[model samples]
Target: MRHRLAELRGPGVPAKALDARALAALAANPGCGRRALLDGAGVDKASLAERLGAPAPFGQSQFALTRGNAFEARVKADGGAELLRLAHEALDRGAEPPARARLPDLTATGPEGRAARTALALREATAEAGSWTLLDHPMLALEVAGSPAFLEPDAVVVHPDGRWTVVEIKSFPMLDGAADAAKVGAAARQAAVYVLALERVAAHLAGPPEGPAGAGAPRVRHRVLLVCPKDFSNLPAASAVDVRRQRAVTARQLARLTRVEDIAAALPEGVCFSPELPPEELTAAVEAVPAAYAPECLATCELAFHCRGRSRAAGAVTPLGRPVRAELGGLTTVDDVLAAARGEAGDPDDPVVAALRRAATLREQALREAAEVAACR
Candidate 1:
């Protein structure tokens, strides 16, 4: 019935349309200025009332992937209407079909998209070598805590030792020291969720135990591997999680899961599962994902312009898309970049930023001189 209902619905409109509506509401209500967009959508208030759950609600991997596909379609189409049409077509087909994946155009440089393309090429190379099954492989739904759940790992491989390993391909290059712990921990948690789900699936398929009767059990052990570049410029590296780490993560996540009810209760009236954070905060937050601003995020993040605006305003590309306007300690404008270039943004606090600033000044000065020369001639 749920399947039929989904089939009956038309393709989904872009989440931006929903965001636009929410933004409009915020515009309309300047007093308390409601931040709950999900409530405005009508799903938040009605569906999840008083549901004190254990643990924070995390998105299933399949749900994340499906929404990602929808966003990709929207960006490729340049609007919401076309996204809706594509979504409806997908729904009518009963299950979403695989579409050709979009690749970023790296040569057209505004920023460092090539770094991402390089990482992708390496992942493809690994896939070619059969180090892992390539992405988009059809995976069967598995049992989760006695309920059926479907998942598709970014990559999966059957090791020669006969263990199933789940691979999450992150485009970020590993940073030095323990500085990247939070980033790594988050990835590990997500991977652990998949591991737990997969374990249940393996157990379900093992069926009834047979003693001397020669019945074999499924040989799936939970292991996870995260593939990331060790350094900039396509250096190969990976982080492997042993069963012990997986168990520790699983325990922590499960404990958090139990409080899902409380989180739901604490949410403002009418809010739904849709997450919300200020555009400013969210931009800063993802930077913690280390190269999370890969083409995927740039294309899909509705707040990309907001983040980019902040980055450009700040004058340094290191923390791209940061809002430094009005705070003016560092370079905050094109003029500030110019000043820095001319030894003017005070000290050489940031040389790369100063260099870009200097270039801009040179270009401006050249333009002015060209105009004066032309006028005189």
Candidate 2:
């Protein structure tokens, strides 16, 4: 399967593994077969985007990147004193606060070794549950589209009670009691992936997969701690985010995503995505896979601009947004909608067509009125 995906990427280019952010984005837009196949194959979407003539949007400003690292360093400083204090306030309100924390050493040579080391740390934490344990920069593996994606959460907190909590630290400010809704949502989704990954580790901790995490098992809490900057200050503020919904939704979406094996099997015998190839060949390789493009993809996908251009060129109305496309019913393209509006296609008696006609009439009247006002002026 790896060989097939590599073939899809041509001869010499190294495959790019999907990081946590990319996996979260993939979870958000699982319907795009192009994204699923490309990501599953570990193809470098950014390079593909540039080669296809649509560079992705700007990445983080250097200032933001520097600030983020500084903030994280501060939060994890002094053996994670500040982080533990915040965690105490966030999840262990009823119990006494932990004065000390165990910072486990999970250094290993590779991802598999690191994952095994993390699993050992988690089991150790569960067995010796006298104090708080923090697994910092632990590596976790989750299988997506038949490929293993390694994820690193900010921290994992193990309570004295044998349950584990996923801790997510973000540089984004939480202002006046709340953070930006969009940023918070993205963070929540990302955290949910971490939680799901933690659950897999929990499965190996000895419970029969359905029982409570106790003497024989360790459970991953559904509510994760979200730590962010408080107001405009650098002080970390923590809150519990209930990711039950996000977890369930992401799990369902992930399961529904197209498997990489199937995508590879369906490909033509000699397809490749090598940037070394001619533009025409590269373009043909990309277009061979069907993509469900929409405006929302811009925020989460690097290939959005390229896909949007193709969608627009093909007159696909989905670029207008899903709601608008949904309203158009069987009319899947902008040209189709325009033709229906002009009574050149679609039965007028059809409810969708009638609504489009009415919308067209209102738009025409509004435009003429505006023109009249301009003419008089």
Candidate 3:
């Protein structure tokens, strides 16, 4: 029986460390509103921000606690430079710590403490290949962009022919379709950033003339190799095929990497938004507006309490805040969902409006009966 990716990689303590950092960043800066997320059907920024900001009863980190079980698993599922790059990028962008220790202090005892050492061991292995060379080896610096990114992989594998692969280990089951395009894209962009950073370091060491790779030798090409579990629950019966799928995913991810300069330019001056929602849309969607909620809205919003109260006060049908169902032409929120749910919102001849009006009556009746029962109680 073939072994799954997770079995080989074991637990991803390093990955968990990265997630902790990300959660910390989110708390430090909670971004714009949830309206855009509602519109896009994506992750709720407000909820995430609130969760991050809320003090844990036990003084535990929320991200670490919530994702603790799957830290290793997620690391297994995450592929290549993309995930690693995101970790590095998030760290670089967020906090600025004083140089208490110039280097990562590799020999520190304990599993988590020795991450830097494990990372270096992997790099030395990768540099053995003819095509790859761990530039400026055995020296310390603040950024790994100047060195082979993993920048510290569990191991870096340089092919005899000059290609390089960064290997990350994790212990988690691989699930198909659960991975979103945006998440994958973010991972890919991250790896691409590492490649760009390493290339700069490599170029500097080799000296200029030919290109970023150097004039005399062909540039070192890089790939990310994510090791993860083949099946749920660390079952070894699963195969290594999961890694192949991740590789394909990484390829797709490369297409989404925006140039670092471009991303820098896009960021608003002196502003950091949590949840990473688009600033313009966020400003328009949330800000001093009347709150409202519906069954759908309640399902995903942290601001539901506020919205629900507002909706009830307004007495609007569909319970989606102030906009009466009639105003939306007897439909749900968006035009597409409304068309699908009502099927005749735009039709003039159809009696959709009349039918919705009747439904509203029934809803009111139910509310009145409940209110009477409450009074008796």
Best by TM-score: 2
As for candidate 2, its clashing pairs are: none
Comparing 1 with 2 on lDDT, the higher-scoring candidate is 2
What are the per-residue Cα lDDT tens digits for candidate 2 across 1-377?
78788888778878787777777878877888899999888788888888888988757999999999999999999999899888888798765587888999999998889999999998888777657888899999899988888889999998877788998899999998699998888888898899889988887677432222445443788888999999999998888898889889888889889888887777777888887878788788889887888788898898899889999999899889988888888999888999999878999889999998888999999999999999999
Stretches > 4 Å off in candidate 2: 208-218, 364-377
Give the top-scoring candidate (lDDT).
2
> Candidate 3: lDDT over CA atoms?
0.36
After superposition on all CA atoms, how large is the RMSD of candidate 3? Answer: 16.3
lDDT of 1 by residue, 242-322 (tens): 444744545443332212223233434433232243433433332322121212223233333433444555554334332
lDDT-superior candidate, 1 or 3 = 1
Q: CA lDDT of 266 in candidate 2?
A: 76
Total backbone collisions, model 2 = 0
lDDT of 3 by residue, 181-245 (tens): 44343343334433443443454443332322233563334445444444554321111112234
lDDT of 2 at 343: 78
* lDDT order of candidates, top first: 2, 1, 3
RMSD of each: 19.6, 2.5, 16.3
